[model samples]
Target: MFAVIKTGGKQYKVAKDDVIVIEKLEGEAGEAVSFDSVLMVGEGAETKAGVPFVEGASVAAEVVEQTRGDKILIFKKKRRKNHRRTNGHRQDLTVVKITDILTDGKKAAAKAKKAAPKKEAADGDAEAAPKEAKAEKPKAAKKAPAKKAAAKKATAKKAPAKKAAAKKKED
Candidate 1:
């Protein structure tokens, strides 16, 4: 099943197992996140859409990681005004894996658990699950802050030629 949901002033059409990056949400990795503002839900030919938001419909996801988007620079210049400014920004983001789409007010946890079998199925042991989650945490923690020390040189301004012109006139 697929559903369209809204978050961070944006809309996303998502399905089970889809990994998506979105505006930062306050939660650690592995935390469950649910989007309640569902615009539409559908399976094949059967579709239901909300006038504003579909009643009793939601999308459930698990936070895969917290991340930052690529750095973007914003530069402004005023021609002939000796004014220029350069700034850089990086947006905070969260990577999430959609686990379930629910309709008719179904609680997400029930279905999400059903989607991924817990323990002993894949790893064949309960201890391995926590170890994997622990191992992944350090990787996310190693993010270096975006480098802001290197500002682009503003070399557009040129030395005035008025003095040179006057010297030539005197000669």
Candidate 2:
């Protein structure tokens, strides 16, 4: 199954066993995270989309690793003004592995109600299944502030490089 989950003001499409890199999330490696803002869910040949988000639908995942991306260089110059600027940046990222997709508890409850009448002539065991699925989900933790130290360091290094390069061009 596959699911669309929203977090950190972004949306990501994920599936079981898939590894995805996203904006940093607060948690140690191997810790579990459940995304309750599931926008959509799908199984073989069928899909269910939510109006904004499906109530009770969720995607469970594990934090795999934390890392940063490659540095990007920014440079600006003005002609005959001796004015120039240079900087570099890198973004922190987190890798996660998708584990499972849980159906909306509300949907399951509604379905069970519809299905109850047909199986009623046999037993009451079917009702128990929905109850177990309705158990509470874990609450999400607050996100940690991203560090800008790398960007500051990169800027400090690049300013000298830019000055040296400009001098070489003039020579």
Top model number, lDDT: 1
What do the candidate models score in CA lDDT, each in turn? 0.85, 0.76
Per-candidate TM-score against the hidden true structure: 0.65, 0.58
TM-score of 2: 0.58
* Cα error of candidate 1 at position 145, Å: 22
Backbone clashes under 3 angstroms, per model: 0, 0
Compute the lDDT of residue 59 as modeled in candidate 2.
79
* lDDT of each residue in 21-101, candidate 2, tens digit only: 988998767667778899989888998889989877987777888889889999999999999999999988899888777
Q: What does candidate 1's lDDT look like per residue over 1-171, in tens digits?
A: 899999999999999999999999988777788899999999999999999999999898998899999999999999999999999999999999998999999987633333256533756776777888899997766643222222323333566667744444553
Lowest lDDT 10-residue stretch of candidate 2: 137-146
- Model 1: lDDT of residue 142: 61
